[model samples]
Target chain A: MAKVLMKGNEAIGAAAIKAGCKYFFGYPITPQNELPEYMARELPNIGGVFLQAESEVAAINMVYGAAGAGARVMTSSSSPGIALKQEGISYIAGAELPCVIVNIVRGGPGLGGIQPAQSDYYQATRGGGNGDYRHLVYAPATIQETVDLLMEAFDVAEQYRNPVMVIGDGMIGQMMEPVEFKEPKKRPIAPKTWSTDGTKGERKPNIINSLYIDPQELEDHVIRLENKYAEMKENETRYENYNVKDADVVVVAYGTTSRVVKNAIAKCEEEGIKIGLIRPITLWPFPDKAFEEITDRTKGILTVEMSTGQMIDDVKIAINGRKPVHFYGRTGGMVPIPDAIVEEIKKISGGVK
Target chain B: MLKDNRIRVITGHYGSGKTEFAVNYAVKLAGVNKKVAIVDLDVVNPYFRSREKEGFLSDLGIRVIGSSIKGASSDLPAISGEVLTPLQDETFEAVLDVGGDPIGARSLGRYHEYFQKGKYDMLFVINANRFETQTKEKTIAYLKNIEVQSRAKVTGLINNTHLLRSTTIEDVLRGQELCKEVSEELNVPIRYVSCIENVAKELPKDIEGEIFPIKMYMREDWMS
Candidate 1:
């Protein structure tokens, strides 16, 4: 189709529709309200369902219900609303239902603030909800990535019969950017192997649920989830590395903060400071092994975010504390400007006068 | 006592039930035959908000003002409301449901001059379980920062610390202690301690605030 200038949130909504998602349920929240509003307007035109649920809780459950019925289902929300949806997410994960969840994150410890924030990195990567489940997490830094990853999210979710999260921040959701919508990829027809559609002739009733009180059965289910996650890590790990050759300082970031770090790296390069970046495309199954390859060449790693050191813990763990890792960020709707990041890079590189 | 006609600024941590309190209190005050207006100044948090349910509040004869839902993409016109102009008129009581946290509360800075022209009481709600301010000292510091950012003194405290569907009397007691600490430290009165059930018998004698009971029913129509 024709390319259009779209906000990241709208791009995600459109991409979901193109990916055969016919059921969308969500509550309107800032930074990502456009997704639902767009879906509300467009879904009816295509004979799809769009529901402005009473709350995030109801919306996620509605998504669960739709996904259970073997429909391509999706939901989007900001951090606080996403927190409210965690219970449903856990249930979805337990049920092994295929669904897409988009978290256009904002600041939060509890209603932290509705500004662009990478505060939910740990929550997204480490399974925000509960139990021993992990979602296929795709972190998109640009508007184009938002569109592309959303389409990929559905494919990945179905392949594993698990929940997949398209994790972006307020910057991606709110900022206007020029984007070219590539022709929608042809998706496979819904697998008829295990869906709740009434049995026709030879098939039997299919049940999709997360409740398994049997210890051995639950253990078997957990093992199945683990194996799926292992397969995903082996086959689905993705990241972007920039200017790591002989670099003394490596900055690790993802989503919007990574864009700022990119600018900071350019500034440092101008000053003859060799600073590189490792931006994870998939936050869960985080590019830990990818980062480990460069630990020996880099002097230290700087973890940057829009929140106070939330994602730094992950970076530190990824490095296994082999190198000194420092963190700098602004909290509660305050974004870290490129200058601040550049300054931190200079400080870490010992180039500060 | 003179009729306190200042714009009441209600704020708290997330999931602290600030929106529920603000909505019920604003509607209750309006129900008592008072000219009441509520401006949803919360743009930060998303889930529990009075503005999202503007249609319901408007039915109760409460004038609801908020940021244009259309201009949500841009931070245009920081909380412009007709309610501020009528705050000086003792005939109307204005309540601004500021967003949670200091940054969310900072949007109120634009209305500082207008608030100064009339009486306004800024109330800070406290939930002891929320991060960053689970203790009294931390909560006081957060409130002070909010006070500095908005140029509005927190004149009262509301104890609303409750877990989702798991709130207990013990939680309320802990919240009460935090409330007392804030009241003494900030020299602000405890305006009300909110609870879903009536636990008036358990309240300490020295606790002076009125017990505000909240009844929240999930609408069946919305469910369908």
Candidate 2:
């Protein structure tokens, strides 16, 4: 409703509030502590609930509790914190609850530094938590995108009756930029039909859970999740193509690093370095088809990241090595400067004599 | 401390509770009627910092400036707001809360000229367990890199290493010892060692410097 300067984390929190998310449960973790803190302050004013749970595990369970009561719910944490929440997330997904999870990722495999990183690409896309379930994943590169996608995530989660994740990194969370809040759209009231509200006349008691002892029933549930994922692949794929027309080199990146790659492309354009960017907005259902088309036009594809080339593996798979695919990145939360990216582009294009 | 308005740089490793310390210190200064402002220059990490609580700081009459998501694109002109004006003014006291690690410190390069123009104090927050530099020597080396990039001298040390959920008194003492060792070795003053009150009670009497309490938002009695 108002034009405000907001960081990516704040934007997501605001969007969630506007999108009728009345319940937020989260633990403080970097590069995403802002989201929870924002919620803690704002939720009370809106007659909503915010709980800083004991741990990430406890926070996810609180989300599960809120979602079960048919309240729009959300939880946020960084890579390591998200790892701890995976158990609850997996359970939430199995129960087909509608909830939004935000992961402002940092470098990881362990307790990583609180710097922007894209190492969680595989984790977010391939399912960070275990199970035969898939959470609808939206990877937002900009603060505005973070808000927009967070809103979209709620709708997607409700539509599929599953969990949705708005995956970003430290860069998006910390950066403050101007954003105009879109006019609030009319949101559907929380679906009370199947929720576990107190049993009333003509309605049976509703139980939402991941536990199913029957082998056939579990198989049926797995099949349902698989079908939902397949449908998402067909209908929910999102990506952005930048200056891709007749490009010699295509750079593939997502989240914060994509912006850096785009800047590098612009810089290189001055020197007649024709490079393009394919930024995947949805990391899950990774835009393989989009890269396939770009590969045909470009001589080679490069994946840039703030990690040790984690997303490059996915790019290689997407291209199937039909065109030369290269990896350029800095690990341990080190972001490649535009100059370094330009150098790599020159090396790949043979523009450097 | 020089009277010519200077930008103070505060930094530390992640989970070091540097954000809490910065917020408290900034608020404490403002409470004493100082014309204070804090620039959240921590773009490296997303979660725990003054930037994350910009609204809170702004509410307290302290200006909080930082790069937003829109500025994530390097092509976008760095649009600093009114906070820059006060930093340049001689009457204002500004604190720059640099991000968790070296990458966060890198952002200080842009404000190097401002630091050079005025008196500045760069405080390196040390947590004993974080980074590859767990010991004093390694921590100093890390701080040196930060100083080289930010062009600001590390004038003080604030030891704040503690486990998030299970912090004990022993941990704070260990942090104090490390801070003392680093202070003596680097010839830097130990400004204040941060500790949660629960753990601060068990701290030995020999630990130097004033003890600052960490106020986390999660605590139910935070307002009290």
Candidate 3:
């Protein structure tokens, strides 16, 4: 394995290439411009297609077209741009296409700041598009983790016949760290008998569309997608627990915020505060099982996020009122410093409500 | 050795990698206990500015003077007072990581008199492998424009032609040839040919100019 210090955005781009993804379509957006720039400069040399489409709307549709044709295709954007592609994303999911989409997220309800924020958690995990479908969402905290997840993201997408989103805050996107692209796994996936390129006069033309105007037919499709999501919940959920074996406060977080929470947890441990961390590697399929590992000593659960408090829902739903859950966040481009999180931990421990 | 050239000043266009080069250069000097300090004058774009790297460099005992409001909500161009203080420390050599384009060099222009007053080598890092600086004449124009904007003459040329991890020995050699041509045409000495460590190890033994093997400071995290 070869390791190099690379930014998160760059590692994702390289991992996409390593996964044999030969087609890319994306519009330029901050914190993620590096990915497209890398693809633009590198793709041509390898005889791959890197298209800077007219707009984010067009880009996602192009990815949809490419993925539908059986090419491993991808696209990426920051908050605002990803917003524009919601319609296309919904269609892709409805059509059950296997593709990779990365949201190197920035702050937003609208065209927010360029800085990193995990404001897109609800949209990403809940599905941005209007649909009765869900995509496998991976929220990687480190550059290496991002690479490993991304290298397998394509295979996961294909395996489930659904889209795979690598959601990360701007920090995870822009920060520099060593990332190693390991040898490609012989990921077993169902062969594409559904690709439109085939049936060359041997069979009828293949069609890929998400529209099901009929209520009952659409309901059947929705049930089918729901079953797939349930299977994913049973099999694909992943998480990491640090020092939770004996702790009173088990803080839950994902992506960039988990790093800060871990640091905060260390400070509390030194003071004999007995705090721990549970990081969700996968956002969707939520990693709800992590909550079961909490102990009798676990007095409280705190969910930390870059946004005001999006992932807290998943944490609460998972904990199911078994323990009181707290939330600490930094929104609109502010990163919660370690000290701030430590304060939150103390407040929880001292029974400050 | 390249270390002899103290008070190094780097100025180039956006994406020319002046910040990355300056960071590695400062780290190298600090590693040798040379009392190194890096001054960040990039008030133009705050995102990739050298000041953002203060925490990383300061951990290594290298004093970094960057924007006071670095990574803050407000990205106003707030240059720190400590920026020029390092230049006064005789024991401390400094690296002035100037910003991109004429607009960016305005901050350097504020300290132009001070830089010219000291024993410094203003390096015009050639933006090789990029279209604007692909040719000698075009590269010369950029150098001249930056010099005029910053009001400082470039004492030397640094061939930093690259395409991240994709840079091969041939790319470095090709860049060296361009630097050679520009070196002769502009009458500026070719001080170093900067390449990442991996490719530098494979550089031809008989290459021209001093080869300065450097770490990738640019957003090369994506390069495999």
Candidate 4:
């Protein structure tokens, strides 16, 4: 297929359709409105379902219903909107129904602002809903990568019978870039035999519920979820290593921040500084293995983000105090520029040297 | 510089480089010592609207009119009454940076009377690399939709096709081919072939429209 320029939000909608997703339920929100709008305009043409629910809360429940019935479903919202859907997300995860949820993150403890920010890192990786449930989370740095991951998000969700998140800051939702919908690598996916589709008296009806009232049954269910999460940690962990070997300073970042960090690393290189980067593609699995690339020459680890160091906690755990971790960030919808990141890298490198 | 009419309305698909073309055309009009006012009638897209560059364009003596809401992050679909100033007054050579779809173009529907009363050139911008406008048929569908929604006929066509930093001469030519087809089909003339200077220099002179070199006003160096 020929490459065409597309905004990140529209590309996501197109990718979801290409991935065989036919049901979309979402509400309007800044930076991510294009995704729902695209789905609304195009879905009907393809005999797919697109509904603008009353609110984010209502939308996720709609997603829940569709996913339970063995349909590839999706819903998207920004930070605050994602917060509203947390309860439903928890239910989806607990029910072990496959679905995709996209968060084109904006700054927020509340309705913060419409510009890009990664403050929701904790909310995404730590599971915003109440439960011992964990789901797959993918953070793509580029629009092409965003579409590619979106195409695969459904397969991964169905394979594990778990919810999958494809998150990017508002930049990834709004920015335009050339993209081609490439087919993802084939994965071994089990049939949706566990779905609540009617049995027509041929077999016992499948029940979809997150509740296990008995304490032992609940414990067993929790352990089963844990094992699924363990499998995901083993198989789905993805990270990118750039110029990591023999570097004076290593930087860890993801999504839009990682792109800025790459530019900063290039600028540092011109000043006789060797800087390496570990870009986490999956925020959940956290890419702890990428830290092994930090060599003896590495002075310290620097984490850059659009938020004020939310991902720093994961970085600390990943490094496990093996190297000093430094942080540089901009919040309230402010994006970290390359020069600012370079200065922080210099500051960390200077202290260790 | 579109001197064919006092009011130049720029419309196209979102990401079709309509805002970029409007900014460049406004700057060129200002360069010629003409009094210019650039009205940002784009309420559909929250990001990268011409209103975001108000300060930069203001310093160049181009008056910028945008949403009544002030803050940068506010996504309210509000347009200020000041937008009508350029349309009412004949002294200013105005550039209207309209939103990119049929729904977005509806913002201009309210001012249909003013457009019809005054001499206006509604230039429909085209980017062949854009998904919806990739083919002649698709491009015509969008063009016809914009016209119906805006309640205004497209007076001119602009081949402002690009892939941002990755744009090449061939990409611009591809846009030209689509624009030429649309022009022939609709009887609207191709008015400008817009692109960055490096790519603009490589375009063949036989192309239908005049080459208009543009700077990266809306896009930043770090965007790619």
**Highest DockQ scorer:** 4
Model 2 chain A is weakest, by summed lDDT over 10 consecutive residues, at A183-192
lDDT, candidate 4, A166-234, per-residue tens: 999999999999999988999999988888889988889998898888999999999999999999999
Native-to-model Cα distance after best TM-score fit, residue B14 in candidate 3, in Å: 11
**C-alpha DockQ of every model:** 0.03, 0.07, 0.10, 0.78
lDDT of 3 by residue, A41-143 (tens): 7888889999999999999999999999999999999888988989998898899999999999988879778787999999988877886778888999887
What TM-score, over all chains together, does every model reach?
0.62, 0.64, 0.73, 0.97
lDDT of 1 by residue, A1-353 (tens): 42344556767877888888999999987778778877997899999999999999999999988888888999999998998999999999898889999999887888766677888877887766889998878898877888888887888888888899998888788654445556545555457477787777776788988888899999998999899889889988899988765678999888878887887787788888888888889888888876755746677889888878877877878888688999888877776778888888888788833
lDDT of 1 by residue, B95-140 (tens): 8888866777888887887566347777788877554457777887
Q: What is the TM-score of chain A alone in each candidate?
A: 0.95, 0.94, 0.97, 0.98
Off by over 4 Å in 4: A351-353, B116-118
Error of 1 at B101 (Å): 30
What are the per-residue Cα lDDT tens digits for candidate 3 across B76-172? 6788888778777767788999876666787777776566534788887775665457788888888888888888888888887766666778777
**CA shift at B84, candidate 1, in angstroms?**
14
Instruction: Estimate how well candidate 4 is docked, as a DockQ score.
Output: 0.78
Give the better candidate number (2 or 3) by TM-score: 3
In CAPRI terms, model 1 is classed as incorrect
lDDT of 2 by residue, A1-353 (tens): 42344557777888899887899988897667768877998999999988888888899998998888888999999999988888898899898888999888887779867777878877776776777877777888767778887887787788778899988877778765445556444445446577887886767789988899999999998998899889889988899988776788888988777877777887888888789889988888788878755645567888888877667777888888688888898866666777788888887887822
Residue B97 of model 2, lDDT score: 76
State which candidate has the highest TM-score. 4
Q: List runs of model 1 lying over 4 Å from the truth.
A: A183-190, A295-297, B1-224
